[model samples]
Target chain A: MDNLSMQKLLWGVFWITSLAIGMVVAGRLWHMRLLADVSVRSRVQQSLQLVAKREGWLISDMSIRSVTPDAVIIEHRQHMRGRDPRVCVRIPLGTLEILPCTS
Target chain B: MLLRVLVFGLLQGFAVLLAELHRYLGVHTDEAKYLLNIPYPHPPLMRWILETTDGWQHQEIFWRIVFASLLTQGTWFVWDMGRKLHKDQRVTLCGLWLFSGALLLQAGTLFMPTITAIETLFLCWILQRIEFLKRWSALIPLLWLEMLFVAYQGILFAPLIFVALRQSGIAPWQRWSAFLIPIGLLALYTPTNPLTIVATGSVSGMSMGMPLEESVARVLKLWVIGGSMALSVLGLYGMVKSKQYPLVLTLMLVTAYIFVGFRSFYAILFTPLLIAGLLSAPKLLKSSAFLLALQIAAGTAIFLYVPFPEYSSARSVGDALRVAGVHGDILIAGSFGHEWQYLMPGPVKRYRPDFTNDAAAIVCLDRCVAIDRQAWQRFPQTTEEVWVKIRD
Candidate 1:
């Protein structure tokens, strides 16, 4: 084979090998992006529960409906130890509000 | 089936190599030129291909043959990966076709974040189908590595460390250490290449600018700069939270260019990686329709934002000249005055670059040049006015 032709063939082989490996690696990254893990979400939920108790407030309900980078939503009815919740607080996107201890 | 996949695997390597070669050979002109200078993200596998082909010089037949081989191999690699990942031969072929279509729309348009986004989404697909954690374990390191790169690129060190620790499922120290490897490597790499810091900074809305007093101009500046920061942050955050890597990468580009002074079109390079990842696994796509829609909508928004004809067309400059009014025969000069050629069917001549004073183009566009007062007097008959002038 001519020198140039042989060189092209060799380069092709090298290129093929590296990209193949990179693609496999790139593929796994995609996998990580897809699955949702419980580590952080669970911690947040647990903390909320603890706070709810200290305030003498009963969390009427708590659920993980949707989680995006902007905000996390937990739906709960507020109730003091003896009283039912008549008021609800909805936080705006990018805002944080501390719930009342009396709940 | 194994061979089909194996062949495609090889093509993926060449595709990345070729993408890099293209970056080496070409560059974007105008503002993006000085603003950022990063190596194409796919890592220029094609240059390696070209280098290896050195001995094949002087034989046209073989040269053509190798050229054709690379293209065919790249396409097949894409198709095969799709098939294997999807666990369906038909989907693999369709995915390949879809990828080819996207590449045809634009190839070797290598910006790292966009490509990472698409690849991330595709990888997520592969992970879902993998089912067996043991089989997938070998691949997770690469996933971590890319995120490490993203963290460094966007300066998201804290959250990246957080995610790596949370996902590692190991003891606290082990997880923390896993996160540190990337930082260690990143530090070694960044100083060794100070260019990336400057490049990333310019494209991250942290461009170097002189400090100034609080005034109307400063307030306007803050509004512009702050607004860009907010947009970039939002776009990146939205993609990450959605578990859509492609979208995340897309958002990165959106934020970087709009807020950080990079081009949105640069996101094209991610096309191949996206093709490889998404095509690899297809069935899970049904649930991902929202993400797909989001990407398209975002892309459309950018397109609607097309400011004018590109610089090369001269049409954009002609629009600028029209804004200047019938100041007809005088030679108008600016950094990118060649554009005035097409803009001014009237006698809109550009002043010589070196000869023209700094205030030279400020007469046309307010490009903050210290136009010498003497030079301004030279064109006494002419005056400066703010008009909806053309942009590069």
Candidate 2:
């Protein structure tokens, strides 16, 4: 590869990486409202809806077994929040309560 | 488009899964690079998941990669978009996407679950950039658009976008006019410990080898991409003169060819061109197949012949992982670390990603003497039954 091609390739890598990353950030910035509008309410309501779906037990087959200031244990399902660096909270199986499928 | 993704995505996932060789990955290749006391975590994550979850053995390591491999397909989408705009339709872009660059080296084959997913996510965003900027043109959407413009981090294909745009008569900076995106993305990224990013080429603090090797490898990688691009242009010229645009996307094949030929992480951004080539142009298929054959054969020979000192599969390290599984976790007493994780089932990774707390770490140790006491100490919970298995 000649110097120009090398330069182009390097520049190609640098700018492309930069642009894609920049756009991802831009998307987040632009979509922040949409995401928040979607994420927070949906998170809580989805959990509640999940609870409501259970048969007899208020605890569905999967429910949070323990809640602490630092962590919340939603049994059986591991909820991973955050990308790039993922922050994960593992929910043990025992904590989950499966609600019978309502026929 | 959705079916296109599914058809190609499943093929990619299967290819990567089949290409994966457990012995090479988990036992001794990667850790050998860093020449570190620490191990990589791909296999240990799988082992840990297996141990922690109990008998879910039927669930193969392939599934873990599959979950995240969608992002791999997403990348294929972006490469396609760029190739389309270039009006080149003379090559097999998709096959090249899977076979070239670092992909040819069998990357996703040996690592953790999210490894492929992260690559995929970055690519999908690149694909969306065209539509968002072209149609929406809304300032509010620009914020979302802004997230994508990292200078050199992800979506390593942005330069291609600019290149294609400039070629197509779009003014420079016009595509990115809505928002100054890099600023917003800064929020999402935890600042790289500049030293680590430079020295390690990653944020994780994994200990590695002589700086010289890493630098040489990186330099060679850049060279390969440059060379491939020239070959692609040569290939493009060969086809462009022939007047075959409708059934084959030349630029898509070009981008795909370069990525597959170079075999680097950067290939992730270019895979989408393959998808695009497949969707729009089918003429590049013959060329793509030939290039892929050449790349795979050469890549296999390169890896097989390259000799870095610490990478020894000769030792009975393979037996240890199996024993460790029986023993709950092996605690190598005197032995230093090897690529235990990559050699093992992937998708099972450490939070730190440096691999200290990984299962492979527990299996292989700086001190090989620790192996004798492993039963009593490491898996204190399973001593009774586990020890008998070890003895027998």
Candidate 3:
């Protein structure tokens, strides 16, 4: 191969290598970050279960009222069938201590 | 000589000021994502740069300094670009000053895709103007790959490739191949660098067919934040008057951005052409110094007053964390948890119930996951509920 072709080959190789290395490094970093913790969804589910068990509500019947970064608010219907029968409980994150949520 | 010195001095001064203030700013959530190598949907090249350069650590202030340095050096490229395009020192000096005074001096220091895009645009311009691509036809593939990696948006400016190769005397087949090779290579890199993401984004961008009023508001913001309303208007006028490739390039960029999705930072790319137009009107040359002063004052005011909410919140949280001496399995929950992860002293993880431990401090940002308001030491900093576990 001529010098120009050789040069071209080297340039292509260098860039491809750089790109590959960069991508690999980025991927590895992402993988490490991913592995660092449990999935947020699973965590939220655990919180829900804890809240349900403590409140004497069936885990299946307890529906997620809202999900926030700090806590998941779970909604439960009281045994009393009346207007506005649904009651909401606050499961503050970290402690999972259920509290009465107003409004 | 005087104008050159003045422009350089102004650029350096603003660059230093930005670097100084950037130190106090909290690690923005976007910056955190990039630093931590979080798998964002956009192109990974910018993240790669951020992660590699910061040694795979959260060194936001250091990166800001580096960005500021690059912006200062970019002023030189802008000067040289003006000189090459206009072939007049006065035009070059005037354009340089105008560029130095623009809001870009502040925005360029940010750890965003804006700087990468601006740098890519500058390199593309330099390559074309120097006819470097024409001479080295083989380098086209490498350039394209680099452009794609650094700023996939660079693909939008592909007209420069044709302009570069237009009179290279290379056979039409070779010229066409030079331009076409990158598009083919893009497919090969698809597994790693997904062009589909760009396509998807573009399609979604189309779906977001903005109302005319909103579109006008955005354009107005682009002009004002880009540099100045007058400069953007003159830049448009100048491009039209020159009837050059720059005009076509400007139109392509503006149309793509406005119709596809508009961002004020994209103005960094347009400012150069605007400066070029400002220079074209020699009648405005006498008042150039006054314009520069006005722009400097304007940019400075924006820099000082513009309340970047993320940065402020980050700073406040970071300070509180530092004071609390937070460490060892820090659990960050809520929006911008990645940001807290970057600020934390030890292994910072997103809050998970299964992952909970007594030793771990749960930081609930924004609205704390319904934190027991009575028990946890609530650091009511910056209107966000910053909860740290005080007990087992």
Choose the strongest candidate by TM-score: 3
Please write out the lDDT profile of model 3 over residues B110-201, one tens digit for every residue.
54545644545464445535565445555554565566655545566576556555554567875676566555444434433222344448
- lDDT of candidate model 1 versus the reference: 0.37
Candidates 1 and 3, the one with greater DockQ: 3
Task: List runs of model 1 lying over 4 Å from the truth.
Answer: A1-103, B2-102, B109-122, B129-138, B146-169, B187-192, B204-258, B268-392
Ranking by TM-score: 3, 2, 1
* Candidate 1 lDDT for residue B383: 36
Tens-digit lDDT track of model 2 for B150-196: 12222333343343333333344644532234334443532211111
Instruction: Give candidate 1's error at residue B261 in angstroms.
Output: 3.4
Q: List the residue pairs that clash in candidate 3.
A: A69-B334, A70-B368, A70-B369, A71-B369, A92-B370, A93-B369
Residues forming the 10-long window of minimal summed lDDT in candidate 3 chain B? B187-196
**How does candidate 2 fare on TM-score?**
0.40
* Counted clashes in each candidate structure: 35, 95, 6
lDDT of 1 by residue, B1-392 (tens): 99867856665554555455433333233211111111222122222333243333222223333433344344434443445443444443333323332232223432333334343433433433444323333234344555445434333223422443354344665455445554554454443222344445655444335343323343333222221222222323434555655444543443434334434343332343334334333443443434444444443443344232233423444445445453333334344332232233343323433434221232344343434444453222333332222222
- Classified by CAPRI criteria, candidate 1 counts as incorrect
